[model samples]
Target: MNRSERRACRRLRVAGAGVAALLALSACSSSDSDSSAQLDSPASASAPDKLSGITVFAAASLKETFTTLGEQFEKEHPDTKVTFSFGGSDALAASITGGAPADVFASASPKTMKVVTDGGAAYGAPATFARNELEIATLPDNPDKIASLKDLTKSDLKVVLCDRAAPCGSATEKALDTARLKLTPASYEEDAKTALTKVVLKEADAAVVYKTDVKAAGDKVEGVDFPESAVAISGYPIALLKKSQNTVAAEAFIALVQSPAGQKILSRAGFLKP
Candidate 1:
């Protein structure tokens, strides 16, 4: 089997006792047949993680890096299953406020996290785990010769930007304002990924998206760095929800995100330390 499948089978094996605990807490785990395959092994035989399943709601910009971190966390805590829900930070915050069941919420910006914290959906002080900034994502060849913030304002260039409600969009606006340049894009998307996708798909000539999104796109597009982006750096904050079913597991997941290993994964994905 491949690595991920082996890890999954290992998780199932390690989840012998966890299956019993999970059933007692909530009926949201593996099937009976899977659980029947293994009886409780001695704790000394193989020490498994205390947590069984951890669901996290994270910002869209965190998808690639968080997935890597989540898998690493599950490896460390073999009994735990980490599931993620990634979207615009604002949308995820709205869902949390609307009572969607989630253990952790990792927002792209502190302002979005405040939405849940203000509504009493979060339990403790949120930690700023990482930072990100905007960049110009253009076609592979960048035929238009787009270089800086001002280059986007060229009348012929078709540009896409994230909606102002999202962190990336707000950051883009700040950078534009910092450079004293005004831009009107062809369209406004919901998140940085969507904005970057427009450029990747050739639907738009360029887009203002997170540096991470541009990096995640790999050779699908090219990233253009500009000085004004420094004016709008966004802080990523993570917190445990107040209504979590397994507080211990949720807290442990948050701790891993702030750990050195997690930081390394994020840094490799073009994220900056908070």
Candidate 2:
């Protein structure tokens, strides 16, 4: 073959080899791109579901109000199921300290909340959400003619008071002390709600409880306002627990309680906003 032809033949061969290599590289790249795309695509999106279940420990005085609030909250957040245990603030605090599986706690007094905070059992700062003032709860008919705080100290009134250990009881003590009166109650209840219950069931002629509690009791009891009650308002504080298994749910619940809707609900239930 001629030299030029030989040179041309070599060039053609080199160009043909280059085209084959390029084709092979393009095929490998296509395969890799397909594999990468598959890896990059998201698996699936999950629909938000209700938190399995959350346990809330709240003060006894919050029974009706919190129960109603819980029902409303559940309706608003279908993904969350709220359960509650309502008792004296001291008892609830003790339960939390005893390692009870509570996701949230609503206390009737800062003193009870202090117990939780001091023990390092709370997850965050407790927020005061509501205020409650003391009131004289009497039988539906007010048969005793009890008119004011001074009436409570009458030798024949037959009154029931919460134990001083309870928030309501302590607040009652403070109010009475502020008014310079000493009362000899027929019985000292373990909690305010219990004292009110005593009056409702005709076990006592009168009792001291939160204004909200009397309202919650409806016509079953008659509420008598005393000027001294203004001095012993109880602030309600709520907090999430540090060891809550449902931290996210607990936080969501707390947020709801602090929201305008929550406040409205509480207000409708006779709770004074903080």
> Which residue pairs clash within candidate 2?
50-79, 51-79
lDDT of 2: 0.86
Q: Compared with the true structure, what per-residue lDDT tens digits does model 2 show for residues 20-51?
A: 99999999999999887754432211112434
In angstroms, what RMSD does candidate 1 have relative to the true structure?
17.2
lDDT of 1 at 15: 90
State in Å the error of residue 97, model 1: 0.6
lDDT of 1 by residue, 10-52 (tens): 8888798788887766654455544654322222222225447
Q: What's the lDDT for residue 230 in model 2?
A: 82
TM-score (all chains, Cα) for each model: 0.81, 0.80
* Segments of candidate 1 deviating more than 4 angstroms: 1-51
